[model samples]
Target: MSAFGKDGVTGLYETHLPVARLERAIDFYENRLGLERAYTNDERRVAFFWVGGKQSGMLGLWETGTAPLGMRLHFAFHASEEWLLDGCSRLRDAGISPLGFHGEAVEEPVVIGWVPAMMLYFKDPDGHSLEALHVLPQPPDRAFGIRSLTAWRQYAS
Candidate 1:
């Protein structure tokens, strides 16, 4: 018997990122980003936050003894352009600048050249790459396909 149903696959209730300092990450997520710290497990060197008042979904930070610098990994979250600007302002106030901006707000809202959206990338305290993005115009219609023939074969075969 399988529990899987029409929903296909379940999404993660929480996501965790390892860092060097829990306190700093907590301050960034809670104070700057306006998220609420829900729980902290000092023994495990873990801290959690709840965003937008949702308790089930959480962002977790893990204090590690040794971690690489300069963006060990990159991830993104969706937000409005206003939120992106506000977040960017807060990060700038804290002495951090985004990597670059992408999408429509780059002097081209919508055209044959670029899509309608904006992306702001930055690094966390431990140098993990993060981005906040907003979609302006809706995407064009298209049939989805694997990027390469090898990918299609790997999935089909």
Candidate 2:
């Protein structure tokens, strides 16, 4: 059904985002999220952080004064199911509101049946959408659609 072969690519290694302030972004990512600082270019007003592990994956933040209207981007970070399940309280404690797919505040993660993954959403200081996700062990079920994790278990059972 697909034209591409299996050897096309492995996985995502890096992503870049525009930020209003480099220091603030660095603080949120480094001090808050605990990502290791890989490098920072003061001249270019850019910073890089190592995600997961050193030299494995990276996130880059570029200082752009202000994020343009409707320029919000989204990215997800791989997380454990346990971490994602407790995301709501953890995020709330960190002053971040956990959100559902529609951007409404929620107490738990949702299961996207297409991907069959449990995911929680939030926004960064720059208004860029962020997610913490963990793939389920079951096979994908497009017909199942998206729903709360509780509903997903009911349907699956």
Candidate 3:
């Protein structure tokens, strides 16, 4: 018999990102973005945060000082539209700007034209791009295919 679930596989376990400084990155994620720091190790210079709450999701930040400047990465967390708006405000209140899907600074989350989701993109202090996402209900009329991020709200229409 299978030791795991009835299905073949399971969900994602965790995600990791690299940063330049451990302390600053901690502040950016814990204080600025509201993630709870779950663990840290100085010898490894790594920190882990509970993304949605304790044991719900995991994010790891590893300090690597020798990487090239302007290194970029992307990560997304599931959120509601209300949370997305409030999150944008939180970033603004911290003097950080929110970004549209195309990477342009914006005041609100963009409704991706192709997918059934809304997204707000921004970067952490280490320049790793992040997204706050809200998946929408599928239209009852018909199905759609992958499309561009812009005007995603109208895909089902």
Candidate 4:
């Protein structure tokens, strides 16, 4: 059995991203995206939500401070390839041009060695880089037209 036990799906959790306006961010995730509210700690300044069947926990909002410029840290969620592509499409429709690692559209999905998963990354409304990934590659025997990092680099070269 791999690290995640027999089925290999371990516990996946979420981390809070600091925001300036709690209400606005909550509105974005809760109303616009229709995520279900899981819980909130008003005095402690935290709110949790469930998006796409996953518990997207506490999004911390620092009411007074402004977010730093170029906030590189981001939060990610697991999604299907279709959802990933659709997210890209949504960004495009919203007039946000997302560039892949190589500054191009993610022409195809890829598995990052660091995370050992197939992923596509993009930014959120705050320019925070976010990723939607599968925990593992589609079985090698399956024909998803996917490629490993080395393979794509070598093929391009």
Which regions of candidate 2 fall more than 4 Å away from where they truly are? 1-4, 65-70
lDDT to native, each model = 0.60, 0.89, 0.77, 0.56
lDDT tens per residue, model 4, 1-157 = 3666757754555565765566776765666445677777777666777656553333333333554643346666667667654655655555545455544575455655444556666654554566667665433433324455445445334
The best candidate by TM-score is 2
Positional deviation of residue 148's Cα in model 4 after best superposition, in angstroms: 10
Instruction: For model 3, state the Cα shift of residue 93 in Å.
Output: 1.2
Clashing pairs in 3: 112-152, 113-149, 113-151, 113-152
lDDT of 3 by residue, 22-44 (tens): 99999999888888899999999
Candidates sorted by lDDT, descending order? 2, 3, 1, 4
Can you tell me which runs of candidate 3 are displaced by over 4 Å?
1-10, 67-70, 140-157
What TM-score would each prediction reach against the true structure?
A: 0.64, 0.90, 0.79, 0.57
lDDT of 3 at 155: 51
Which scores higher on lDDT, 1 or 3? Answer: 3
Tens digits of per-residue lDDT for model 2, 61-96: 998855355367999998999999899998888888
Which portions of model 4 show Cα errors greater than 4 Å? Answer: 1-9, 31-34, 54-72, 94-97, 102-116, 135-157
lDDT of 4 at 108: 50
